[model samples]
Structure formats: C-alpha cells, structure tokens
Target: MIDQANKLREMIRKKAETEKKTKHQIKVYSIVSGKGGVGKTNFSVNLAIKFQQMGKRVLILDADIGMSNANILMGIETPRTLLDLLKDDLILKDIIAKGPYKVDLISGGADLFYLEKLDDKKQHEILSNLAELDEYDILIIDNGAGISKQSLTFTILADEIILVTTPEPTALTDAYRVLKAVSTYELKNKIKVVINQVPDMDTGDYAYNKLFKTSEQFLKIDLEKLGYIFSDIRVNKAIMEQLPITIINPNALASTNISQIAEAILGDKEYNYNVSNLKQFKNKLIRLFG
Candidate 1:
C-alpha cells in the first residue's frame, strides 16, 4: 500500500510537469519596415484584431517614436504613453488603453528611446510593470520605419519579426538594408515578410522574392513569406474612418488577406515559446543597451 501511494504521487507530479511544458505561451511579434508609408502599422493593427477575433488576447505596442499612430488607426486616444511610466511614475497598467474589440494599446513612441539610458532601478521597475501583461496571448510591436537602435533592439529580441514592404524599388532596397542590420547582430529569430499594397499575387511574390533572394544570398538569412495584402480602396476608407479594415469590412480583399496571414501564424506549430519569454526578452534588451 505504501509503495502504491508513492508511485501514484510520482506519476501525478510528472503529469503536472508535462502539462506545464505543453501549455500555450505568450508570443511577441515585432512588426517593422525599412521605409515609411508601407502600411506596417495598418497590418499590425488589423492582425491584432484578427487574432482577437480568433479568441486570443492581443496587445499592440506602438513603438513608433513620434509616429505612434496605431491609436489613430484604432480610433482611440492615448492619454498616457510609455513616457508616463518613466516621467510621471505611472505603471504599465495605467498607460495601456483599450482599443476596438478590446485590444490593448500602448503608445511607446519616443519614450522607448529613453529606455536604454535608464538606470538599473528604473529598468527593473519597467520590467516589473511589463510582467503584469503576461495575460496577453500576443504582443504586436509596431516599430518605427527605417532602422534605429530601438527598433533593432526590439527586432532582435522579438520571438518573430514581420517585415512589411511594398513593391516599389526603393522599398525593396530599404527592406534588404533592415535585414542586413539584423544579420550583423547574429540573432536567429524567425523573420517573416509581408508584401503590402500589392496589385496582384504576382506582384506580392515578386516583392517577397526580391527580399527573400537578396537576404538569402547576401545575408544568408532565410525568410518566410507570411502573406500579402492587396491594394483595397476600403483600406483607405477604413483608415480615414479610424477603424481597421478587418473591422470595417472583413469581406474586403485586404481584410481577407490579413485574416489568412493570422491563420497561417497560428497554424504554425513549430514555435517554441517559453513562459519566461518576456523576462528573457527584457534581459536581452538590457544587455544590448549595456
């Protein structure tokens, strides 16, 4: 009887450990672009909404410096931003504003640029605050266009990166530049490309292949084509109306394309997420700053 009881206890403990390892983990994806006006923020916001519709808790961190426009697209006002946390002694919970479909938004803006200059104490405070966001299933970081220290830091630390680009020649060259910078860091995070504003599937493929082949040949970096967004006029209308295309017209070609990308992301089973991802990411950022 004693032996049987001990055996049962051991089995239960092992089962609990196994379940813990198999549980879903929060994912962090940084949406970045090499040039402005590539619809990076638009894609980030809509992707967040799609993830929310699919029953995932999503948060969009508008880390676009002075270009923190995700709130504008979400039709919400950011009364407080990440700056408030450092300057006003506010907590992360206090600055997080709710957007459409209950998505969380944090306007980091230029405030994130100051993070690297913070002392260890302030960094710890910010880290503690970020810990409260563990309930979120996904974090979409909308980085500023072009390369910057802040953007590259987030890109390197992110679990995955979505590089948005257009079919323009300038856009493709700039996109390749961003990949080159990432290659210099020797980070192995998965980088996915999203060709936005494409007139057709061939245009999208051409854009992806340009970046794909260039990065593969020059930087030896493998790229995945997440998907593309068509040039839908409804996208413009939705932007002017302060709503995401997905919310205003889910049937729009652009909206459907974003939904497909979201589906593909969730369907990918190879992502290994650790519960300590946020903490690890924070530590890595701090080290980079150091």
Candidate 2:
C-alpha cells in the first residue's frame, strides 16, 4: 500500500510539472441556454469565428455532450473529440481539429455519458489536460441546454457565461429560471444575455425588457445585453451548407450582431483583455482550479 501511494504521488507531481511548462491563461467562455433550439450552437460557433478573425487563437469545445452540434454546424469532420481525450491519456493539443477562421474545434462526442461516472484519477486527468490548454486566447464551451448539474458546472467554471434566448414568452421564462438558479449561486453578475431571432430592435428591446425587469425586481441581477441577432434566412442557408454566417455573409445582420458581441467581449474593461496582464490572468485561473 505504501509503495502504491508513493507511485501515485510521483505521477501527480509529474502531471503538475507538465502543466506548469505550458503555463498560459485560457479565457473560458461558456454559451448556454435554459432550453434548446434557441440557436445556442450557432451563436457559439460564430462568436468563436469572429474572435479568430480578430487575430485571437480560439478553441471551441462542443460541450453539448449527447447532442453535440458545433462540428455539424461548422461542417467539419473531426477524427477525435473530447470523449477521446477523457477516455485516453491524450493531451488537449492532440485532439483539437482546425475549423473555420483557423479556430480549433473539439467535439464533446455522444459518448460523454461515461464522463459522469469517471473515477477521481480520470477526472483529475481530464482537468489537468484542460488546464494545459492555456495556449488558447479563449476557450469557448458550447454547453448543453437546460439546468443540469453538468451544464451548471460548466457555466460556473467559465470566466463568462452568455445566455441565448428568443423573444418568445416560453424562452424568456426559461431564461429567467436559469438566471434565478445562477443568482442562487451568486453568479448573476458574470452572466450576459443575447437576444436571438428577433424581428427588429423594438421587438428585441421588448423581449429584453421582460427579462431585464424581472431580474431587477426578483433576482436583483443587472444583466448585460451582449447584443441581439436579427432573424435572417441566410443563417439557415449557411447552416445547411455547414458554413458560418461570418464566412458566407459577413455583412449579414446576424453576422454583424455576433461580431459586435465579440468586440464587446474583447473590449470589456472588466475582463482585462490587455496583453500586459496575460501572465497574471493565467496565474489567476491556475489558482482558481489548483
């Protein structure tokens, strides 16, 4: 028993040393929703593409688990996925596939059901590999919809959480429930809302008002409006072709809206996107998950 324990300690030390060598800070942003089919996957892919266009090394992790679709929307065939990394001893760099705008993509393949049952050693391995992805300027996690413990963990673990919803009443109600749950954990401040599929700015504002007012009154959370994506048929056409709207129609309204979101996220003073503090930011994340 003593020999086994000593061996485990040495293995853990080696893993830690390997992680320190790649010391970098990855801005983890998780795009999630209360319900599905609100264009969550589309938003995540486009945002990552837009960021890449802005000269950032981006990695998009499809965290939708059972219903992963980022790769399908982007129209890329991935040989390996997050599942492969979790199931094997592969490093993050080994599994990442290149996507549009040179973005790195990792699919959270359908076999993630096994992830929930992973033992402590496996869990530590996964986290250690993720921690080594510090080479990326940003790691966008497109999480599964609804309020599962798994999804919530992703949201809370991210540096920022963007909630996507349509203007429909049901969508608004579901988003509110998500915000409320986030508030219970004091995560309301880190949350941002993006209104998708709106008819016009007036309708978008109308939808935002419903969520804005309720959050102000009930949850006391000031939700930031990350911007709105206008309804566009071109989006559907682009998706059918497995292309990002930014690539197919960069001038389109939806693409423009998503670009603005990328700018806002990059320019936000609170996020400290400056190059000077990149090392500091990385250290903070290390301390966070250490």
Candidate 3:
C-alpha cells in the first residue's frame, strides 16, 4: 500500500508540472505612438488578427480615449463598448465583438468618463474579471496619440510596448521624446520600435537605424527593432473603404510585413513571461495606481 501511494504521488507531481508549463496568462501589449496618423491603430487591428492566425486567442482593446476608432478601420460596429461591461456588469465574453478571423475586439467609448470615474478598487475589479475569462492568450491596447497619464498607465502595466513611427524627422523626434518620458517607469524597459509607412526597404532600414542609434546613444536604452511596414496603396484603399488591408489585399506589401512582424513577435516560446493570474492582475493594478 505504501509503495502504491508513493507512485501515485510522483504521478500527481509530474502532472501538476506539465499543467503549469502549458498554462499561459494573457500577455498584454500596449501599442502607442508619439503622434497620430502614423498607422498605429491600423497596425494594432491587423496584428491582433495575425496572432489569432497563430492559433492564439487575441483581443484588441480600443483604448484611444477621445480618438478611439479601431472599429472604423476594421469596418466593425458594436452597440456595446468596454464601459458597458463595467457599468452593466457584463461578462468579458459578452462585451467582446466578433472581429476578423478568430480575434475579438472591445469597442471603446466615445468619452472616458466611466474610465476616469474608476478608482483603484473599481479598476482592479474590472481587470480581475477580465483575467478570469482566460479566453484570450493576448491583449493589445491601441492608445491615443502623444503621451498622457492614461496612456502611460497602460504602457507601465504592459508586458511589452511597441512604439510606431514614420521616416519623417519630426515623427522620429516625437517618438524619441515619448521614449525618454516612458524610460522613467521601472517596468517599461521592454520597448520596441516599428517603422511604418516606409516607401522601400532602404527607407525602412534608415528609419529603424536612426531611431535605434539615437535611442542607444542618447536615451541610453537598447530599443529593439520589431519590424517595418512598407507604405502600400492597398493600405490606403482599405482604410478609405473602412476595411483591414490584410483582409482586402492579402498579398499586399503591407500585409506581408504584418505577417512577418507577427512571426517575429512569436519567435520564441521558450522564455516564460510573468503569468499574472486574475487576482494578481487586480492587485498589481491597485498597487501601481494606488
């Protein structure tokens, strides 16, 4: 009887280890830019789809506050936004609007009144509920232009941040300023750069190298180059028609770049990132904001 019990105990321990290894928490990524019109929202919408393509459940949060318009780019309209979930006590699954492919989206409210009214406790409650859903493997938040306290909060809480910029000098300068500001936060060190709307590979390389070199030399932070997107006519056409470029023109240059970026983001499955549970996510939110 004693030997049989020992064998069962070993089997249970191994099963627990295997289960823990397979369990992955929802990875939160905040997509931000120094200014608008840099294709930030469009990138966020498509990237979420790419993650879904990789067999991972993805959620896109249109947290752009006053300028939130991700649904417009994806040609999606929802009667309910995230505020409705918090106010009406709706489940996360119910608030999620069906998005492209396997991805889901959380519509943004016109105004941030409900978000602003949320105290630390209230915010924690919402996040705890969100984490409990476990229906998504990742959450991508598309923030508004420039830097604000609200955007900063999202960046600080994120596991990774992708700052999009263009080849223009002014845009790069503004991106550097944003980078400098965000560097003060202790947990925001894993920031990456994405040069968007480039006309060619040369332009893309120049934009990325300039930002990477400047960030290293001046900001004293090693900003990794995530990937670059070529400016394609298909992208403009899709945006004008309120459609995602990838859905409209799968073979377009921009679409190919999106796929590559997604692959690069998922390059390694070895490193175990912090898997914050629902309660831990709530506690961290309260602690960070409190």
Candidate with top TM-score is 1
TM-score of each: 0.87, 0.84, 0.85
Predicted structure 2, TM vs. truth: 0.84
Q: Is candidate 1 or candidate 3 better by lDDT?
A: 1
Candidate 1 lDDT over residue span 1-290, tens digit each = 99999999999999986555435366888898999999999999999999999999999899888878999999999988765776666877889998858899988877777766789887767766765565688888899999887788887657888899999999999988888888878765458889999999888888888787878777857799988888999999999999889998999999999999999998887554322355565566566654
Candidate 2's residue-wise lDDT over 122-159, tens digit each? 75565566556656788888989988766777665677
lDDT of 1 at 189: 40
Number of colliding residue pairs in each model: 1, 0, 0
Model 1 off-target regions past 4 Å? Answer: 1-24, 86-89, 272-278, 288-290
Q: What is the lDDT of residue 173 in candidate 3?
A: 86
lDDT of 2 at 108: 68
Candidate 3, residues 1-290: lDDT per residue as tens digits? 99999999999999986555345466778898998889999999888878887887888888888676888887777678755656766876777888756677786656343655677676656665555546677889899888887688887667778899999988988888888878755547657789999988899898888877877776746688888898888898999998888888888999999999988888746223544544455555555544
Q: How should the candidates be ordered by TM-score, best one leading?
A: 1, 3, 2
Model 3: lowest-lDDT 10 consecutive positions: 270-279
Q: Each candidate: what lDDT?
A: 0.83, 0.80, 0.78
For model 2 the local lDDT of residue 104 reads 82
